[model samples]
Every structure is written in C-alpha cells, then in structure tokens.
Target: MTEPQVRRVRLEEGFEVQAYIYGEGDETLFLANGGPGLPSLYLREPHARLARDGWRVVAWDQLGCGASDRPQDPALWALERYVAEAEQVRAALDLGPVHLLGHSWGTWLFTEYCLTHPEQVKSCILADGACDIPHLVGELDRLRSALGAETLAMMRRHEAEGSIDHPEYQAAITILNYRHVCRLQAWPDSLTAALADWNMGPYGEMQGPNEFTYTGNMKDWNRIPAMGAIAAPCLVLCGAHDELTPACSEKMHAALPNSWLKIFEASSHMPFHEEPEAYFPAVRAFLEEVAARAAVGGLTRKSHPCR
Candidate 1:
C-alpha cells in the first residue's frame, strides 16, 4: 500500500484539521471514524482493499483527537461541530457525492450529516452503530450482568466515585472491551498505535470514559424514530457479538426505508479485522450494487426501494 497523502483542511481561520487520503479511484469513500475521538490510524488497513478496487478511501482525525488540532472548549465536541468538520473536509477536497461510511459513533455523525446534506452523499454504510442509545444502554445492562455480579458492582462503584482509572474498574471494562470491542487475542499494530495516541477530551465529554459508561453529553442521543429523514441508500453492518450489537443494527435497518442489514456472525465490533473474509466481500458487494444502480440514474424517493 502507498503512503496516504496528508492534507490540512481549514475548518476556520487558525484552525485546520488533518486528513489522510488513501488510494486512487473514480468513487470516493469518505470515512467518519468513531471515538468521537480516535485517530484515523486504526482505520488504515480496513479500507485499503476498497482503495485497491478503485474506491478512494478518505479518513481524517477530526479536531480534538489524534493528530488533529485539539481545541480546549467543550462546546466544540458537539455533533453539529463534527458534521461541520466533515462538510469542511468535503469542500476542501472537492469530493462530490461520496460513498460515506462510519463506524461506531462515527455512524451517528454520518446519520446527521446525511440528514442535513442529503445531496452530498451517494450512499452510506453504518458499521456497528445504533440509532437508539437508550436501547444500547439497556443492552449494556444485560452484557454487564453477564460479567458476574461482583464485576458489575466494581464497575458501578468506580463510575459513581469517578475513579475511572482504578485498576479494578479498568479490569472489568477490559473484559467488556475484549469480549465485544474487538475480540482478537492479539491487537493489530495500527489499532495499538491509534489507542496509544488517544485524547480523552472529546470522548470524555461526548461518549464518556469507556464504551459501557456513556455519561457524556450524548447520553440521550436516539435517532431511530427519526431515521426516515435519511434519503441515501444505506447498508447497515454489524457483528453478531459486537458491543454495538446486532439488535442496534436492526433498529436502523427497520427505520431506514432504503436499507438492508448484513451481520458478521463470528465477529464483534471490529469486523474488518476480526472477519475480513466476510467483511470486505459484503461491503464491496453493497457498494458495487449501489454504484451500479447510481450509474443507471439514481433511485427515486417516491419508490424508495430497499436493496
């Protein structure tokens, strides 16, 4: 694989976000990553195959995380701001009608962006994402219970006291992450590198300390009811054992009129790494199907057919 072309995109005067462009293609895949804060490093390999197939995958570390400029204001971490950052990146690069893909919290960013800028996206892929946070929290309760009564108590105690760094707390959450987040015995080097460079600013303020404990500003976030607003062809992807879970993906699939769901049976959150055999083929087929329909003139909203 060739080194990505790094470009600085201006969000506003004195503020520029770092974006990495990988591969060359006629179709553009603009990726919005999760973490609400994670850098784009963990994403390098997942989309490389897409690039090889003539899909230019563009991913960026949004402001306040990774290699992007960190802003001190908490107000800067809102969903609206992230949407705007994506728009700015699109404008700076002049990437028209991209096939947008988002993973985890990035899917939320994709949802809102596609809702507001329907004309900008040709199609969308939401991987391991939920349109309902409340439903997700309820699922977390079930998952935490599976961790045994003792571990649940320890996690709750640490969260209440704000001692998120406590060893016991870390231990419990690590179990949660290991079982659901990735489920790989060995972490990929790119994933480790991205994790090492994490900035807690945006995450703590938006998604809270960890995956299970989402006490941040987005706690009440739920878009399932309003998913009808989305106009693009959407492919909803989720793992059978993902923290985001298959049920969450089901909600979005049911709500989006022109959408379908594909499950990675033996995988968790990061299916690209966990089940690349099934992962890439499913995604490639979906994108190709959408592109093919588009080449013949896009679908009409009156019919709004599901794929």
Candidate 2:
C-alpha cells in the first residue's frame, strides 16, 4: 500500500488532531474507529486499502488519542463534543458528501453525527456497534453470564471491589475478548498499536474499564428513538459473536429506514480484520451502490449482501 499523507487539522483555536488521507478520488470514505481512546491506526491501515479502489479514505485521531491533542479537561470527553469534533474534521478536510463508516464506539458517534448533520453524508456504515447503550449493557451481561455462575460471580466480585486489574478478572476478560472481540489467535500489528497507545482517560470517562464493562458517562446513552430520522442509506455489519452483538446491529437495521444488515458467521468484533475477504467486499459494494445512486441523482436503493 502507498504511504498515507498525514495532515494535522485544527479542531479549535489551538487544538489539532491527525488525519491520514489515502488516494485521490471523487468519492470519500470517512472512518470513525472504535475506542473512545484509540488512534485511527487499526481502522486506517486496513481501510486504506479502499484507496487502491479509487476512493479517498480519511481516518483521524480524535481529541484524546492517536496524534491528537490530549488536554486534561474531563468535560471534553462527552459524545456531543466528539460529534462536533467529527464535523470539524470533515470540514477541515473538505470531504464532500462522505460515505461515513463507524466501527464500535465510532458507530455511536456516526449515528449522532448523521442525526445532527444528515445533509453532509451520502451513506452510513455501522460496523460492530450499537446505538442503544442500555440494550447493549444487557447484551453484555448475557455474554459474560455465558462464562457460568462461578466466573461471572468472580467478575462481579472484582468489579464491586474495583479490582479489575487482578489477574483472574483480567483472565476472564481475555476469554470473553477471544470469543467476542477479535476471535483471532494473533492480532494484527495495527490493532496492537492502537491498543498500546490507548488513552484510558477518555475511555474511563466515556466507555469504562474494558470492552465488556459499561460504567461510564455514556452507559445510558441511546439513539434508537432518533435513528428513524436518519435519511442516509445505511449498511449495518456485525460478527455473530461481536461484543456489540448481532442483535444490536439488527436493532439498528430495523430502526434505520433505509438500511441493510449482515452478520459475519466466522468473525467477531473486528470482522474486517478477522474476515477481510468478506468484509472489504461488503463495504465496497455498499459504497459503490451509494456512489452510483448519487451520480445519477436517483433515490438511495438498498444493496443487500448475502447474510
């Protein structure tokens, strides 16, 4: 792959974040990766391949992670602030009518952005994410409970005591992660890099201690009631065992008026990483269909991929 051109875009007067631009095409794909605190590396590196197909791919580090400025202000970690940050990034980059893709936490951000600024988006991709936090918390409880009463009790006990760093607790989390997060025996370098530099400040404030926990400011956040108003054609993708859960994707798909859903049977949270052969093609097809529709000034039509 060609080296991505890195650009620093100012979000405010003095605060700037890094954005990686790939290819030079008429159509653009703006990516919002998972992790309230992760750099855009994991999503950028893999999605950059879309550049080869004549699509400009743009991924950025949000305010508190990656190459972005990380201030100590706790108030800046809110979802509303992040949504505004996304708009600033789009405006700074001059990405016109982008095909927006949000993975995990990015999906929550993506749904909110589209709700707030529908005119700027050509289409939406919600991958391995949920828009309903309360429902997601319940789903998470279900997933963790599958570890049985003994393990679940231990996890709860540790969580109650604020001992998540304990080895046993972490070991349970690892097992759940293996089953529902990546499902890959070995993770890709890009993913590992993002994990290594993860800024837990924003994560703890917005999401919580780990992927399975939801004791953050956003734990009660839900956009399901507002999803129907999003007019952009949407593509919802999830792995059968995603931590976000396929049920979450289904709920999103059902709520979205113009949308389609796909469940990757052999993958988990990072289907793009776990099943790229299937993942990339699905994303490309949806974007292509949307672009074609825009080109002809036709109404957005649903492009269904095999379930």
Candidate 3:
C-alpha cells in the first residue's frame, strides 16, 4: 500500500486539521477515530488495507492530536466540536457522500453527525461501538474490577493518590489494557505510537484521565434516543471480548432499521489488531455490499424510530 500523504484540510472553523489520505477509489471512507484526543494513525491497520483493496480512505487527527494543531484550549474539546470538526473536514476535502466509519468513542461522534447531516453520508460503520457514556463507564468499571483484587487495588491506590502516572499504576493499566484493548502478544507500533501521542488536553477534558474513569464532560452523553435520527444504512462491528461489548453494537443494530452486526469472537476492542483475519474480511464484505447497493441506487434508510 502507498504511504499516507500528510495533508492539511481547512475546516469551517478557519483552522486546518491534519489528515492522512490514502488510495484513489471512487468510494471514500471517512474515518472518525476513537479517543476524543487520540492520534488517528492507529487506524492504519484496518484503513490502509481498505485503500490497498480499492477504496479511498481519509483518517485524520481531530484538532489536538497527532500531527494536528494543539491549541491547548479546554473549551474546544466538547463532543459537539469533534462532530462539527468531522463535518468541516469532509466539506473542506469535498469528499462527497462518504462511507462514514467510527471506532469506539468515534462512534458517538459518527452517530451525532449522521443525525444532524444525513445528506452527507452514503453509509455508516460503528466499530467497537458504545452508545451511552454512563453505560460505557459502568462497563469499564466492571472490566477493571475483574482484573483481580491486587491489580485493582494498585490501580485504585494510584488514582486515590493522584499518581496516575506512577509506574505501578501504568503497569496495572497495561495488564488490563492487554486483556480488553488489544489482546495481541505484542502491540503494533502504530498503536504504541498512538498511546504515546495521546493528547491529554482533549482526553482529560472529554474522555477523562484514563479508560476506566469518566470524570470528563461526556459522562451523561447518550445517543440511543436519537438513533432514529441517523436515517442511514449502518454496519455495527464489535468484538465478543470487546470492552465496548456486543450489547452496545446490538443496541445500535436494533435501533437502526437498516443495519447489520458483526462480532469478532476472538478479539476485543481493537479487533483489527487482535483478529485481523476476521475483522478485515468482514469489513471488506460489508463495504462490498454497500458498493453493490450504491451501484443499483441508494440505501433507503428507515423512517421510524425503534420501539
């Protein structure tokens, strides 16, 4: 696959967001990455394949992460800003009617964007999806608790002492992260770089200090009630061992009238990294079906809400 070209796409907000563009296919997939603050490069595992397999893909850092601008203003880290940022990126690039895809926290932004701007979407993909922030945090809490008493105690002690950066705390988090985040024997360098480059400005203010906590502004964010507003055919992707959980993806599938669900049984949150054998094939098939549907005409999204 060709290397991603680092490009600048100017948003409506009059600021340019850094992005990586790959492939030259007619069908463009706009990626909304996870971590309200994570660099978008981790997406290369799944997306680079899409580009090589004949699809145009655009993955970018949202304002404050990766190669993107880092203004350090907390006021710019709200949920709405990211949603608007996605819209601006699409518009500035003139990437007409893309197959919008989001992973983890990115799913929340994708959902809200589709609801508000249904006209710009050809299809939607939610990978390792989460619908309610409270539910997400609760699930995270359970995952942390299941990590055994000693590890949990170490993590909690560090949190209580405000020593989240303590080596003990970091070590404990790695144990938990290895279980639910990647499950790979060794993490890919891209994912490693993403963690190293994670912008605390956006993460701490929006997603919290770490994955198991949620003291940020998104604690009450819930988009289930607004699922009907998306009005676009969707693909819900999740791992059986996912921290986001299959239930989260199922909730979206049930609510979305024209939606399908795929679960990678052997993987967790980062299925692309953990279960590429299943993850990539499933995604390719879904996109193929989407392409076939588009060739015939367009997806007729359901007009009613889930009851």
Candidate 4:
C-alpha cells in the first residue's frame, strides 16, 4: 500500500478535521465511523487494503470524535452538523460524486447526507447500520435476554444510578459492547486506543450511559420513509451474527429503490475487520458496478475512469 498522507482542513465553523488519504486511484471513497465519538483510526486496517487495491480511501474523524475539534456545546454534535462536516470534507478534498460508506452510527449521518444531497453521491454502503433506533432497541432487548436477566439487570442498575465510572460497570459495558459491536474475542489495540481517546463527555451527553439505552435526540428516530427517496445505488451489508442483523438491513434494502443487500456469514457487526476477504471484495465489486453504470451513462470523466 502507498504511504498515507494526512491532511487537516478547517471548516467554516473553525473546526479542524483530519483526514488520512491513501492511494491515487480515480475512485474516491469516504469512510465514516460509528461511535459518533469513535476515531477513524480503528478503520485503518480495513481501508488500507482498499487503498492497496487501487482506490483512494479517505477516512476522517467526525467532530467530537477522534482527532477532530471536540466542541463543548452538545448542539454542535448533532447529526445535521456531522452531515455538514462530511460535505465540507468532500468539498475541501474536491472529491466529487464520491462513494460513501458508513458503519453503525455513521450510517445515520451518511443516510441523512445522501437524502439531502443525492446528487453528490455516486453510491453508498451502509454496514451494520441501524436505520431506526426503536428497531435497534428491540434487537438489543432480544440480545439482552439471551445474555440472561442477571447481567441485564446489573447493567440497568448501574446505568440507572449513573455509576458508569465504576470499573465493574465499565467492564460489563465493555463485554456487552464487544459482543454486539465488534464480536472480537479481545479488543484490538488500535480500536482500544481509539476507544480510550473517545470523548465520553459527548457520548454520555448525547447517546446516554450505554449503547443499548436511547435517551438522546435520536431515540425515536426512524429513516425508513426517507429510504425510498435515495436516488444513488446503495449496498446494505450486514453480518450473520450482527446485532443490527441481516433482517434489519434487508428491510432497509427493500425500502430503497436502488439497493442490494449482502450478508457476511462469518462476521458480526464489524464485517470489514471480522471478514476482510469477503467485505473488501464485496465493496470493490459494488463500486465497480456503479462506476460501470456511470461510465455507460457518460456521467463521469473517461480519462479519470473507475475500474
């Protein structure tokens, strides 16, 4: 893979966002992380291979996450702000009609951006994303049951009492998050470091005490109706064992007019990390198909063509 060149751009609001760019391919791909607070560093390994395979991969830390300027005002961290940040990054990089990919919470921002500016997107990939928080809450409840009442009760009690700082509470939350989020036996160093640097202040104030609970503004949010309005070709990916589940993503695919669904058999929430071989190929194939269609329709430059 080529050496990654990191660039920092100042948004109109004076917030500096960092982006790591790799490769010189014509196809520019933007990857958005979940956590709303999770840095883009954890996505490095997954995207590095994409860069090696002839795609210009750009991963940026969203505001209040990673290396970006984390503002104190909670209002500045909303999904609308994030969508604007994404647009700013795209414009700053001059990456027009780019392929957009979002994981988990990032999918919310990506979906909103696509709906609001479909013309700017060439294609979209939503991986392990929860389109509706209510639906996600139901799925979390099912997983909680399988985890047994005792553990669930303990988790609830700790969260209710605002004891997230307690080591035991942290441990319990970590276990549950790992299982449903990444499904890795142990958290990888890159991911762990990113998590360590996460702006918990923002996460707590916005997303509540834990991942399962929804006390934030997005609690009752549902984008099912907006799915039909998306004009770009979309690929909705889910792992067989993902907490988001194939059924959830398939429902999104059904609602989208121009979309496809793919499930990775041996993966969970983080398919790019859990099943790189399948995940990368699937993404490349989808982008290629979109590029081919665009080429046929004379929508893009032939000189700087996509593979």
Best by TM-score: 2
Candidate 3 lDDT, tens digit per residue, 1-307?
4688778977666677898889889999999889978888888555788887889899888998888888877899888888888888888777898998899888989998898789998889899978887777778877888878888888888888888999888877777777778888988898999989888888888777877778889888888877977766788899888888787788888787688788888898898888888888878877777787776765544421211
For residues 117-138, write the lDDT of model 1, one tens digit per residue.
9999899999999878889999
How accurate locally, in lDDT, is each candidate? 0.86, 0.91, 0.83, 0.80
Regions of model 1 farther than 4 Å from truth: 297-307
* Candidate 4 per-residue C-alpha lDDT over 168-237 given as tens digits, one digit per residue, 9 for 90 to 100: 7677767667776787687677777887888866666656666777787778889988899987878888
The ten-residue window of minimal lDDT in model 2 covers 298-307
TM-score: the better of candidates 3 and 4 = 3
TM-score of 4: 0.91
Is 2 or 3 the stronger prediction by TM-score?
Answer: 2
Model 4 lDDT, residue 300, Cα: 25
Candidate 2, 1-307: lDDT as tens digits = 5799999998774788999999999888999988999998999898989999999999999998998899888888899989999999999888877889999999999999999999999899999999999999999999999999999999999999999999999999999999999899999999999999999999999989999999999999989999999998899999998999999999999999889888899999999999999999888888877777776664344334433
Off-target runs (Cα >4 Å) in candidate 2 are 297-307
Candidate 2 Cα lDDT to native: 0.91
**How high is the lDDT of residue 102 in model 1?**
94
Please list all clashing residue pairs in model 1, or write none if there are none.
none
**Model 4 residue 279 CA deviation in Å:** 1.2
Ten contiguous residues with the weakest lDDT in model 4: 298-307
Q: Of the pair 2 and 4, which is ahead by TM-score? A: 2
